[model samples]
Target: MFTKILIANRGEIAVRVMRTARRMGIATVAVYSDADAHAMHVALADEAAHIGPAPAAESYLDGERIIAAAKATGAEAIHPGYGFLSENPDFAEAVEKAGLVFIGPSPRSIRALGLKDSAKQIMEKAGVPVVPGYHGDAQALVVLATKAREIGYPVLIKARAGGGGRGMRRVDHPDEFADALAAARREARTAFGDDRVIVEKLIEKPRHIEVQVFGDRHGNVVHLFERDCSAQRRHQKVIEEAPAPGMTAAMRMAMTQAAVKAAQAIGYHGAGTVEFIVDAAKGLKPDRFWFMEMNTRLQVEHPVTEMVTGIDLVEWQIRVAAGEALPLSQNEIGLSGHAVEARIYAEDPACDFLPATGTLHHLRFPQPIPGVTLRVETGVRQGDIISAHYDPMIAKLVVHARDRKAALSALASVLEETEIAGVAVNTAFLARLVQNSDFVAGKLNTRLIPRHQQALTSFPEPETRTMATAALAASGAKFAPDAPDPFDAISAYAHFHPITHRRAIRHGDRTRYYAITGLGDGRFAVRSEEENAETLVLPAEYGERIVPWPGHLTIFDGPDNHTFQLHDPLEQAGLAASGSESLRAPMPGLVKLVRVAPGDKVKKGQPLLVLEAMKMEHTVCAPHDGVIAETVAEGARVNDGTVLVRFAESNTPNAGRPARRNIEPSRL
Candidate 1:
């Protein structure tokens, strides 16, 4: 094994690699950008080096800078952890040329499996069944459209050089093909700098199952079962599980054999994943599965494979890069138990899962239950800022149990006990998914989330008790150890036996007045006009944060976090300013495209601009039919709520009158 290695990545993956390297007595170096100067991975490494600015192109993607840092730190190898430069063939070749071992597949192997079109063709030749699609080199639109028509409707246009669901679109009809293709090409160019795309037949009710394979320099390879990653949103995997729920012995054997063959055909070494699309409608049969593509590095969902097989993939990667033989043969490798992993992201499920950025003022995870196995992989700490310059994934929650039912149940409870504040998260959504009947029964597919949209997307309204608790916290109620009861300190005054405090709390689109009365001792009576009165003891705080500006208080209850703003009488009495009527950027991102100019008329819901954030494209639309009075130019980096377009009210009775416009950006 190498004595020291450098991790050429950031976030949880970097931390994950370091953990294994340290356990194996290998010192690790970390490279960071300006934005990640104080990142968790940097703090964990034996040594750290600054590469460049925050943008990936300037730092993480700068192969020269990374090589220099590795050489300066005397690192014998470099591990590209799953993103950024992980799958880049040129970067792999560069590392080897710099006299440093690249802890992954050979550059030649990467090139053979890097592009989707090329990889598909290679798989077909290897006798690994591939999805039927046009893998030709023609780049003309007409040619691609004709191919799509011949393949039938509902074709998927995927970027030849894409991963993580970027640069992909599904066309349902011939008329929609042109628009979808144009959008796919644009996104592909922006994401991968390649505008080439391949058209494929869209499988219905497809379950995504992938086999984990490993290889060594001695030309030996083996497979590690499979993982079912069917639970998804926006074409990205949300939850993944190992030892696919309904997988049969015959099916598993065939898939694993094919996966091993795929790896050997490319002379693949180190860790890689061969992803397959299974037609659930026909069950997991050997002939019913087709190769989608291969991930040429360690996967984000590798933890589940580790839990089931008792294997450390990172350790294998290092040993193989050092020219070691395969750790175990295919016959000796076996799965022990079921494991499930849920990706907890800083995103809002209600708003099309748009990525959210903010400070993690408070972060907490569930305490481990005895006899139950649970693991959390994260690279963030309390008070760490989740920046918009990187992926929004905050952590990965993995749980293992004797059976699928037990694992599913444990995962739901774990999610319920997890607490986070200062930003939107998908904890509640994840909890709902684990507890969902269909999901529990293993009736899963890529469309699971969309099929249960209403149940999974709706955010529950804050309960009356939750609002009352927030009101109490906001009203200067703190946990006092000297007083036996929580209300003892506040109710000490005999003259104020039944003090009543009224506060207005807003949740979602509704605001309700809460009347909380202290009943001495440790009890309090809380009531809302919309609900019945309930008397109870003060709830203990799991997490809390107080902001002085608008007197906002946030409290955690189960899986839900509630924020209440203290109503100001002065603001209600004309001290506060009116709202604005302009289009604002929903999140911090780069303005990729501006579709309208000043004074141009646009209809309601018309696309006005596209903002690229967290590696996803979000289109901003006009709120109403109006003329653009002012607008920002393309290629501008903007913060959240930065006004991008100001509108002039259209065809109103006061059309000639000047309207109050607040186009200036406001600091939060």
Candidate 2:
């Protein structure tokens, strides 16, 4: 084995590759940009090199800089983790010319499969079935339009250069072909520097199934089963599972053999995935699957296959690059339990799935459960910033179970417990997806997410108990359905035997006040708008999580997750105040003590009240010497601009202002 290797990519994959390299006693080098200086991958590598700035063009994609970094670090090989320069044939050839190993397929193989058009042509010549379409190299838009006409309506205009649904457009009718072709070309050129495209007969109900194929220098190859990536949004995979549900022995044989044949024809070496589009309308059939394309490197969803087969693909990649023979034959590899992987992205599912960028102020992954293995592959920590310059993938959560049903159930529960703050995520969306009737029943397709957009993308409204849970979680308490509730500390001794905490929580377009009367033993009587007080009890099977931060709180009740803007009475009172600044709160914190009462004369700069946050004391002072017109209750939790006290003046502008007023949202 080589003494060391350099990973020329960032994020989870780079971290993933280094781990296997380390296990095999190989020291690894990492190359990073300014944006990834403190990235988790950088910290994990044995030796690191700074390539360039944040922009990929100036950094990760600059092959020369990467080669230089490897040479300077005395590394013997470079592993291009997927996405950036992973499938670039020239870069692979450059690595070989520089006397360093490229831990992937040879540059020749990449060249044969790099472009969708040429790859499809080669597949046809190799006797591997391909989707019927025009794979010719004609650049004229008129020519492409002609091919689209011949292929019939509903032809797909796909970017011949790269994948990820970019540079691809689905033209449902001839009238939409010209405009779609233009848009696809523009996207392709901007994304891959190649505007070339291919017209493929669109499979109406397509299931994206790809087989994991491996080859070595000795001309031997083996298949590691398949992964179903049919759960997608805009052609980008969201959930992927191994041993595709409902795969029969005959169909598996045909698809796996075809994948191997495609890889073998390219004179392939190392790891490669042959992706096929299956016509799911008629179910899996030997003749219904056709080759879509081949990925020249490790896939983001490789973990699912690894979980099912107990093979480390990265190890295989390194071994094959080191000229080792194939580890196992086709029959030697066996699939075990089913495994599924869900991509945890830093994006909002509600807002067109737009990418979100922010510091991961709070990030927590699900813990392993009985009879299931949970793996979280990530390169970000709690404080890491999700930058706008790169793909906004936070992590990949993989789980393995005895069967597909158990695996799906565990995944849903785990997703429900996932807590992420500061950036919107698809945690809730993915949770609902796994439990979706069609998905759980094994009815999947590329259009699954798009077809069920309304149901999957929409977050369910939280119940009154959920709001009560949010309040309790914010106060630093956790409740398990079966565990005895030990919440006496929050209960107050008054004329009554119990204490009720009333607070207003604003979620979505509505703000409702909840009354949570503690009844002891982790139970409460809760009431919300237009609802009577009901005994709140979480089912023995729990699907609840609460994450609280400054001025905000998030509650997850099974399939429901929502962030509430906590409304303090102080804030409601402060908003109506136009008389003095003292009525406004300085920050979100607890009102520790109120020194003066209403009508009390105070001197300018005198300490009014003590507010506490982060274990520190901050005293509110008098804005000017004046008589106090009103004072908020002591020991109240308040947000910024929450009215603390009002000064009596000629301009008692908001003394009688109603506490609740119609609040209009800012135009987005």
Candidate 3:
């Protein structure tokens, strides 16, 4: 193994690579931007270097700065963790030319697969089952549209240089083709600096199954089975699992062979993933799959593969980079158990899934259960701001169990017990999805999120009875001073002792009264006059209370607590502030373009502004058919909920529809 290596990335993946390097007795050099000066990855590394400013283009993507940092720290090799410069062939070649090892596949191999158009042709030559698409070099829109017609409707317009779902669009029909193509090209140009696109036939009910393959300089390559990443949102993976459910022996063999062939064809070395889109409308088949693309580096979901195969892929990366052969043959590697990984992002699921930013005031995971370790890979800590300059991902939570059902159950419970504060997250949403009957049944596909949008986006709208009960319990505990504790009120009323305490609680559109009958040990039992009683329990870690009698509500724990927060029914409503005059930016970003001028009459839902953050463009629309009084100029920086514009009420009441609001969203 090398004595020292530099991580040319930030966030959790940098921390992840550093961890494995530490275990292997390799010192790690971490590079950070202005926003990540105090990042967890920097603290964990043996040494650190500042590359540039907060913007990725100035720092993480600055190949020269990263190379200089590596050389300054005496790192023998550079590990470009999955993003930024990971797939940049020029950077890889530069590293090698500087007499430093690029701990991944060579420059030639990356160049071969980095461009989607060329990679498809290569896959076709290798008989790896390329997706039926137009990978031609024609740049004309009419030509591309003609190719889309040949490929049929519901075609995917994908950027030739895209990954992570950026610069991709799905057109359902011919009418939407041109607009989608234009938007895709604009985003492709902005994201990848390439407006070229390829049209592909969109498979119905597709399951994203990717095989992990590793190669070394000795002409040795081995396949590490597959991971099912069908659970996705906006073309990005949400949940992933190893040894795909419902996979057959024949199908697995064919995929494994194809993956091996793809790697060997490019003389690939180190860890790589060959992703395939499986047509699941008719279930699994040996030939019913098409190549999606190859991730030319270690994947975010590699932990699932590691949990099942009991092999450290990072170790293999290091070994291969050190000029070693493959560690194990394909037959020798056996998948032990089912593993599932849930990406925990700092994002609001209810607010168009916009990325959220805040300091992590509190963060903790439930203790791991035996045989099921909950691994949290993160590069931030309490009090660390989740900067809008980078990915909203806070951590990756991975769990392993003997079976898929067991793993799913374990993940569900863990998600609920996870305590995060100071920032909104998708934890509750993830918990609900894992507990969904359809999800538990392995009824998965790319459309899973769309199919379950109602359940996933509709947060718990608890009934008044439940809300009142909780409020009374929380309020009673807060009001009582020396009472044997208001929590004791639950059991205080024996079947005969009739003492009822009234409390008002509001949930949704109605407010109702609840009579509390008992309270003890942070538990309260209450019932509406016409409903049955219900008991509630709040975790003790939040705080403890001891009341002698009723004086004034004395509180113990609540949202103010460090570790836990009661599920506030109005939290979502508060976050989704809608109405009236002002247009607020949904998250921190720079105003990219402004279309409406002051005093301009704008129609409801008309695009008035665009904000670029986290590598994506979000258009802000007019809140109503109103005269714009003010608008934020283009290229201005704004924070979450920052008022960018104000509008005069529309002259026509509820013109065409209810007043629409524009909330520019942040990227994830």
Model number with the top lDDT: 1
Q: Estimate candidate 2's alpha-carbon lDDT, on a 0 to 1 scale.
A: 0.81
Q: Where does candidate 3 have its weakest 10-residue lDDT segment?
A: 554-563
lDDT of 3 by residue, 1-668 (tens): 79999999998899889888999999999999999998889999999999999988899999999999999999999999988899999999999998899999999989989999999999999889988989889989889888889899889999999598888989998889887887788677878878899899999889999999999999988999999999888788999999898999999999999999999889989999999999998889998998989989999999999999999998899899999888898789998889999998887777667777777766776789777867887778877888788888888889999999889989987887676766768887888777778778888788998798777877655444335434564444332324576443444545676355666544323445656654434444456654564544433223333211122122212111111223344753553344345766766788877888887988877888777777787777775577987888888998777767777663432222211134544223
User: Residue-wise lDDT of candidate 1 within 1-668, one digit each (tens)?
Assistant: 79999999999999999999999999999999999999999999999999999988899999999999999999999999998999999999999999999999999988889899999988999999999889889979999999999999889999999588888888999999997888888788877888899999999889999999998989888899899999987678899999898999899988988998999888888999999999899677888999999999999999999999999999999999998898898788888989999999997777657677888877888888666799999999888888888888899999988889989889998998887777778898899899889999899899998899778878666665567776666565543546765444554454736556666765543556766666555555556656555654564342343332235666655556566667766754441233334666666778878899988999877878777777777777765688888887899998787777777653432222111121111100
lDDT of 1: 0.82
Candidates by TM-score, descending order: 1, 3, 2
Model 3 TM-score relative to the real fold: 0.84
Against the true structure, what is each candidate's TM-score?
0.91, 0.78, 0.84
**How many residue pairs clash (N, CA or C atoms closer than 3 angstroms) in each of the candidate models, in the order given?**
0, 0, 19
Q: Give Cα-based local distance difference scores for all models.
A: 0.82, 0.81, 0.79
- Deviation of model 2 at 380, angstroms: 1.3
Checking candidate 2 for backbone clashes, the offending pairs are none
Indicate whether candidate 1 or candidate 3 has the larger TM-score: 1
